[model samples]
Target: MTLKIDCQLRDLDFTEVGTHAQKMEEMGFDAAWTFEAGQDAFTPLTLAAAATKNIHLGTNIAVAFGRSPFAMAQQAWDIQKLSRGRMHLGLGTQVRAHIERRFSMPFDHPARRISDYVRCMKAIFDNFQNGTKPDYKGEFYQFTLNNPLFSPGAIDHPDIPVYLAGVNPRMCRAAGEVADGFHAHPIHNMSYLKEVVLPAIDEGAKTRGKSVKDLHVQTMVLIAAGETQAEIDKAVEDVRMQISFYGSTPNYRGVLEHMGYGDLGKELSQMMRSGQMAEMPKKIPDAIVEQVAVIGKLSEVGPKVRERYEGVLDRVAYYYPIPKDAEIGNWKAFTDAVKHTA
Candidate 1:
């Protein structure tokens, strides 16, 4: 199977998205993804459409609870129209605290609710694309009205692919049942993907009478790589810090445990709760880092990534590019190696 290489933009700024997208496409990347943390995901992608062609654009995840289905559909549809069909709608049910406290939105039964949300949005999209009256009723959401004057009917791309990001089985299954893809969390290891996630997807697809092959599985993995040992060590430190920060969040304890670092996770969470943010990174041992990340000479990354995810993954995106200042040749070499092997 040919594994598609995908990459996400740095959260720092999006002013150079067009320039970056052109460069990424030239470097052989199949797609560009953006995340919504403190910024809007759709806007940067909309800007990217003005800059390049061919590379698919998507939100790695925009909060599902933050917007109504109608609003989400409207935004995704507009981007799809502008991109001439190169758009993917990725949704996430972020934790209840962020949804309720940060966004001031209601949150409950995320799996069921998001499943309902997807159905509602698809129903809305169908109504808009087919000029049919809207009448969808779900446990969590209902849409019974669509006025012709305000609705912009079908475009060239009416079926924008939908992907959902989640760490639990309920979400994996839900993605299989209703979404076109599953965006695996960066912290996930091969064991989790093969033992937990794949089974969930299979079960969900079987329940829905859908083929597992119909769902694209994409994962972003931690990387600590460079041309030289010094560069590799520096990148390793950065990834260690990031991994520790993630482990400190109790929500990810299961992932750490899957990597046989359960105690490390507990300690990190305790430190975080006690406001020892500076000490958290120091707690991540080298072994834990090695288990959760792919660290080696830059030349080894592509083959190792391919070895780790060859059968289970459809596409892979790195947590971040290594040797921040490395020449584009480094990235080109890495991607080319994977392509030739695949």
Candidate 2:
């Protein structure tokens, strides 16, 4: 199994990002992905690209509705060039409320939108690489930039891989049909991944006359590693809180409900909607915590990560810093444990 060690950019500043990127590359990490929930994932990704020589730089997910596909294509192209062709463009359609209310953008037919977006991006990149004009006219986006002055000439391999973040079956299927890879949400368990997600992807691929081998399955796993049981308990609680925050959303509640935690899901939904943030974590049951994250000693964490990839996922992106720490000793331990497992 191929393991891809990665973390979010949340716990790292600019200087720390550079250092982490180099260190992660040295530690045999295949990729380094950053988050863009409230911050731009591109700036740090550029810094990571500059700092590392081989490790792939990417976003866990950059919101799609916030920017036009043209802009995304240009950014990905530029980053791929800057990184010497070591860039992965991961995109996701954030929740409807965030898109409609916060960004004032339409969020209709997300699966279809993502499919078109990927096709349009590929066409644009092909145009730049082949010195030809791309004529793309879809329901959502239409563009034809021929002989443009701002074109970045051509790239060696403009076919930079596109990864899609998906949780629902439709979105997962769309990822299989269009994207080069599929990124499962961190809250998902191994059972859901194997039973629900993988089958949907395979069905989608079959419809397109494709196969599972054509796509990569990448999952983000929250890992908290420590030597002592007290430290492990604290880390596990931190993961539980994070899972509570993610599970409180109505969309994610479905997954929790599927896991036979419908009552907890309803409670979390009520709390989140009422803005009772402080009381949210208290509702997350211990059983749900074990299902979501790998929280334990370094020895235990490695096996749990391996379990996720047993017969389903192709890569695991281990997110670090369950809490704040100046030194990445916990991350180092987790990676060392993963290597030992291999």
Name the best candidate (by lDDT).
Answer: 1
TM-score of each: 0.94, 0.92
Candidate 2: deviation at residue 239, Å?
1.3
Candidate 1: regions farther than 4 A off: 321-326
RMSD in Å for all candidates? 1.9, 2.3
- Please identify model 2 stretches exceeding 4 Å from their true place: 322-333, 339-342
Candidate 1 lDDT for residue 148: 84
What lDDT tens digits, residue by residue, belong to model 1 across residues 86-185?
A: 9989999999999999989999989899999999999999988998778899999998997988687889879899999988788899888888889988
For model 1, what is the error of residue 41's alpha carbon versus the real structure, in angstroms, after optimal superposition?
0.6
Model 1 vs. true fold: TM:
0.94
Note the residue pairs that clash in candidate 1: none
Please give the CA lDDT of all the candidate structures.
Answer: 0.84, 0.78
